[model samples]
Target: MTARVDSAPADSQAEAFKRLYPDQYYRRFLSQNTRPDGRSLTQTRPASVVLGVITSADSSALIKIGNTTVIAGVKLEVLMPKDPPDQGCLQVNVELTTLCSPEMRDNRPTEVPSFLTQQVDAAVRGSSAWQPQALCIQAGRAAWAVYLDLYVLCADGVLLDACVLAAMAALNALRLAPVDVTDAGNVVAAGNDAMTDGTSHPQQPYALSKQGTPLTLTCAVIDDRLIADPSSEEESLAATVVSTTVDGQGHVMGLQHAGGGVELSTAHLQQCITAAQDRHTDLFRVLSSAQPPDH
Candidate 1:
């Protein structure tokens, strides 16, 4: 059987560009309360998420918010901690593949990874998503350091939101085996234990902390449209405000008035956060729909 292919018509690009970037004079004159996409000021783009799509990964997730798509994979490795020997660490990296966008090239320098890393680090640190104590095998000794890799195969708008959602979903899908430490303080595996069988092993206490919510939502500003999850063209043509609020819980982390030239009012900023909270339902549904990863 031949694989089915889906694609936009030839005129779609032109149409999209036209829709995003209207004539200069008209754009300047159109100071309507609504957005160009006909969405309410508090509406967010539609989002879909899938988990455990990758058969070989310990945990993985695919997120689609409007035209943007991102995949996040988690890999766990046991290594000795430097300063905090009793605690393991988590390293998160985000890569914007060349195929995703023209701006991301093969050999060129890209700050995307660093920026995303910082954001993820902040979120992870601020929230008690992963217990550092659980990762430790021995006091001032060996532990597990989880490596989270995020690849942006496509980015239309709101890359930060996609990244955070993907990361959280991956964390949820994770099921690692328990690690055993030898008398020499080296990490090893136990025999015949389901939680530590040398493959996709997860230890006991398979739970997240209750201090903070699961994920973050990002809101951006495109022209006069304060949109959640902006498309690439929309992102390019307007000042942006990226804000994220955890589910049920209030806003623990947020960044706004980014990329210069746009000053969002306190009222407008609150509107954006409120919009994100409404969208959080969609995010929750997507996460709830995913099945546990098969290791």
Candidate 2:
């Protein structure tokens, strides 16, 4: 659950209530008829996605859902793990920079990163996007682990939605160099931990596993109005709900509710799903059309 702002406050106390306990007000909206943005129960906000924004990364993308913007980078590395030799792990991290929002500060670790990263890790692990066998070396002695890093360059609303979309696009644009393994099973790559040893190794590049159909889509609520993407101001005013759904695939990768007043009904939930299905064309188009940076 992310945050939200309730529209059509009934009174001054209700307005204050929307502030003091937005989650509760958000719930009231869901139970009532209208949403905060004056949208139908099934409407989603506007969204746009850009690919290969970072020239230096192996793969990168920027996605803006409403006013929320997220940047994602994916880097590939070979390593030896103490456990699960046959399975390559996916690691994700999030950094909410100060430029994203005034609420985020230079003080302690921001809550957005911890929450968004957890969702990303779960989504990648649960989806059939990556195969551990593809990352295997000699049936378990070594493997390759992919790290996906996300940075909140800006945050208007629905950080999870933008981050997840950017992450998928970045992964699709990723290209890993060749891996060399001798008969002795000694694997090698001509690079340091940063992959900048500057020595080119002779090996053929292999494609990664096929990405799962229909990536997850996130929808937040600003009261009864179930906005496909909410901006930061909208988030600040209501109780927010983030539902991660893989349309057509119909898998609920993740679901989180944040804020104070959002009350969702079963009917509203169904409406959100319908909205996500409608957005799939745009989402998949952005994911598949994303181009990788030239190395």
Q: Which candidate is the best by TM-score?
A: 1
Can you write out model 2's per-residue Cα lDDT over 25-57, one digit (the tens) per residue? 766666766465675555556667677787777
Top lDDT hit: 1
Per-residue lDDT of 1-295 in model 1, one digit per residue for the tens?
9988887786886567577656442254336645556765556677777888887677788988777888998887888777776787888898888888877765588776788778876776666555787676665667777888999998777888888888887877776565666667667766555533233544453544434544666666656556566567556756666666565476546553467767777776777777767677677777778777444
Q: Estimate each model's TM-score.
A: 0.80, 0.74
Cα miss at 253, model 1 (Å)? 1.9
